[model samples]
Target: MDESAIRTQLNDAGYALVQVEPRLQGLGSTIRPDVLAWAADNDGVLVPWAVVEVKHRQVAGHSAALRQLATIRDQLGTVDHYVVIDGEWFRADRGLRTATPISGPVSPANGADGVLQDVSLATSLIQERLWNAANRRRHDGQRLDSLELFADLLPGSLSGELVARSGHTVRADRDVLWRAGRRALTAFTSQDKNTDLFVSHPAIARAVAELAGDAISGTVLDPFCGTGEFLWAAADRAVAASRSVELVGVDFSSQMIEIASSLASAAPVPARAIQGNAYSELPTDVDLVLSSPPLGLRLPTQHELLNGTSTKDGDLASIDVAIRSLRSGGRAVLQISPGVTFRANGEAYRQFLAENVRVAALIGCPRGTVPGTGTGSVLLVIDKLPPTKTFVSQLGEDWEDQLSSGGAAITAAVAHLDDKTAKAT
Candidate 1:
């Protein structure tokens, strides 16, 4: 039967109907369901009702259509009821139950638009999954087996393996799992506290990785790795370069750390996530460090901070930790608060940088690039050697546009820095 006829039946059955187009969002792939029906309250608030699939006529492969409907429900989530229409006959499947016939002429409410409602459904479904995952806790330190299952459902490169570590076997893909798990934690925590958790945007994360240079090899670390985005980006770059590197991520949030560990387990290279203070003793002699540490915090002294003994200015301290963690000629690409270049304590830090590290580049990021963070940020690249000509540039408000085009600004600056290094050498 035609879709209009199906819509009429649903409308008569008290549902607002709209056609759903296949579009990729978050973990869901492109899916085009014939129609979506919602039960609207008296105030016209749309509550998810059911998904409908319309087939022209009865075919021998009818079972495949039903399976496709089930996949849509699983990907879209929220709604559990689905209906399949073939010619004049209709079958409704509620959750895992068998499909049953509904006796009526299908009709849908006039002028019902499903686009806005579908967006709402997608957001609600993602939030629900994140909430459930955030609340689940394991006391025995066993690997998060559920995350391994989730990895299989997600797109891109991800897999898991149980490996021996610290006298026990653990899931190797914990850090890869963290890519999604940490987002859930961030969402849940943000809602609970009504505050923005300094989660880096994926674009910003990719830009930072690009700034680190694709030639990067050996060990890489993100001391204040919130959700392991930088580590993931670095891993992807290393894979593109056909180079093998070890990935290490550290974050104080146990939840964040757990997710990061799970995610790193699935990286193309050897990777591990640690739950510890960035101010504490970290792995030394690392080749590169890329991180966006939390801002608006103060610290007393760099010495006290590095020993994991001070929490005066965590923003500055994280940079100090990154600098100290690097090998003699290693590089660090850090996302720092804009104010770090002028604050009183920042002066001392700058003086330290001038005396020790080679300041490579400072790329300013536009405001709102970090979503909840209205404050602007800067990407600071430094090498553990004598000073060099510093290349500084503003990324403007369209920094995201630059990022989308392969972070041209950052790439050019890195190229200039490479030339400067070559001349100096």
Candidate 2:
């Protein structure tokens, strides 16, 4: 009936008590539970088991205690059983149904056997099996043929609407899927020292969208789009401007391409994603280009720049591709490595820009703004026209605040470019 007795009961039930009043990291805040325990299978593999809340007597606060235990279970990232002890009586719930009486000591047996098991444990095992099966299919160069199949394979807790409108399955939430995809890509790219998977900053992506202005229409492209951050931003800008826009994103990794496609499909504007080498294959004559391509690497042999006996760095190669893909008078916003602006090897690419495009602005991003790397970047805005006075600025420590004003600065500079071009005509 008391806390000590409950602990003794759990110990006798083959559950190892991990901690009393344990603090767990939740989605936003830390959650504290009365008791944390683990259950070991026949092979002695310990898994998270239950969270217990002990109450001295049945009172009006029992409902609140139940709710608190439920929150802790949800935050634990698994269907761990939540047990409540009210004197001699105890009940357990896995968030699937009402708490039921769990008399006597708990059992460590999981749902692997043919016998019926706890609802929560059974659901968790089923989901894990399905996930493993899906992964195996993917490894064998196959995919789930239908959403219904995926839904049927899913546990009852997640059986409804297996696939969202975005093509994201109910197997995981967007944030979970995003993190998993990123980890997979990072691991894949880690095999080659020359390869890097850089995720764009939300602040910078928003700034790029703001700088694109309200007049943007027609086709927008992100040839090296990783997870489609720029595409989402561009879609928002197009919606705000009341312009009909078509967005296209390309990435070399199939996983990244899949995430990008799902995100694009969920956007308000018309968008699509392609999985391929951005340098070798991309749509042409785009009205606008927004991208943050991988840097500090040589262009792969399959790249168009390297194919014709021209070897360039990855960043410069991406810039060249962006330039060639843009329509006449179209604009491009590129996030390039800092070396591209000052390195002697980059001078030829700079000269190419000077001769073929109008340099609008180069805004230096502060260090630590990009994810996974501390390397600074430069946002280069170029228009395919004659040269003009380029506005240059370096963001200080308060770079986010500075980037917030980027739209106004870009607007004025674009107006000046328009005025200069008109006079020249």
Candidate 3:
């Protein structure tokens, strides 16, 4: 059904319909609300609760769900009851706190434009208002914090993981963090879905972990550990699998280290974040060295003055440092940018990878893998080959497929590479 018809049916149920599109007339060019609704008392002194949006399609509805939740959160200053109404679908979602789908698709004999759906949706909305009415009366802003926002935007599996990782401690109270995370997750659905918060995306993390295996025993280091996500996740999985793992994160950005430290403090395996260059000065004798370095962004410290654009000296230096830091039979997972994987000049790094390190896998991450960062990154699992003299050049498409294969392939590669190194030594 069209938006207007849906809006009309919901309005009948005491909803103050706000058309989010076409910018809500003379209010302002910017005052565009999908739907504006209010729950009133007998006196009707603008009873402070507003439900926004009458979403139609599923995809756009999901996006609208996040945007509206954020709007509801923002509108908390003026009104308390904020909701996104999806009267056309099988559910009528309501509330500023969480994006929940109420069963609203029962078809009645006299029902038109899905009356059962509308009624069910309305009923849930009313129930939600009742639940929040007392809280609003108490003026509890914490009641409608961002958890609703996150749940609205993020996928369920990812959200569950974030909640699990947040644990007990941190600056924000448990409820407050829960709310902010939920809000961010929900908002993430609408925000750039490509940027991964790391802890939130387990599928990708699991893929990386599978390759890591028993390769990480003593210490695992992430050179460009953004917010220490990989290290915390790695330790969590390792501990679960009965592997004793020590985690360390090194990043140039102090802000990232602080953030990573906060998350680590909440996790079972506490991680250490030191502000140092990944390439030049990494901790010594690490069992695993992993990093996702910055691409194109130049650093002045290691400038060799190669070309007009300077050079990616820091990344190159870090790669060299990571290699030397690893002990024999040690492994590393380099999260390489797509440009580094395909470009001709990248042949040097690829060759360096093939010769100095065993190319166990080269997993191709889909475009949207890293949220906020628009670069496609691949997981490059490498091990230090003893005698350090196997000179292999150029990898084919088979390299991609090799990484895509599961644990068995990785195990076989690690065993074979270890055997070859032993024989050579």
| Candidate 1 lDDT tens digits, 1-425 | 67666666666565543334423353344466666655443334344446666665455334665776677667655353445555545454555345566665343332222222333343333344443444463444544444332333222222332211111121223343434344543444444323235457768878888878843789999888866778888887898888889998888776566556656665558889888877775899999999888767654554453334434677777788888899898989998888878887667667767766788888888786554666888889888878877878888877887765346786678686676454232
Residue by residue across 277-306, what tens digits does model 2's lDDT show? 877788888899898888676854634442
RMSD of 1: 13.0
**Candidate number of the best lDDT:** 1
Model 3 scores a TM of: 0.48
Off by over 4 Å in 2: 1-196, 301-309, 405-425
Candidate 3 structure quality by residue, lDDT tens digits, 1-425:
55565455445543442232432223445545554433333333222234345554654655556565455446433242223344533232343344545432222112111111122222233233333443564476554322232222223222222211112111222222323332333233334333343322334444455566677678989888865656755875677778777788888766566555554544455467788877567787889876767654455655332122334545444456667778887887766565655666446665556555556555566555555566556666667763442322233334434344354444454455445444322
**CA RMSD (A), model 3:** 15.2
Name the lDDT value of residue 120 in candidate 3.
Answer: 21
> Would you list the clashing residue pairs of candidate 2?
none
Q: What value does the lDDT take at residue 416 in candidate 3? A: 52
Ranking by lDDT: 1, 2, 3
Candidate 3 has its poorest 10 consecutive residues by lDDT at: 162-171
Clashes of each: 33, 0, 30
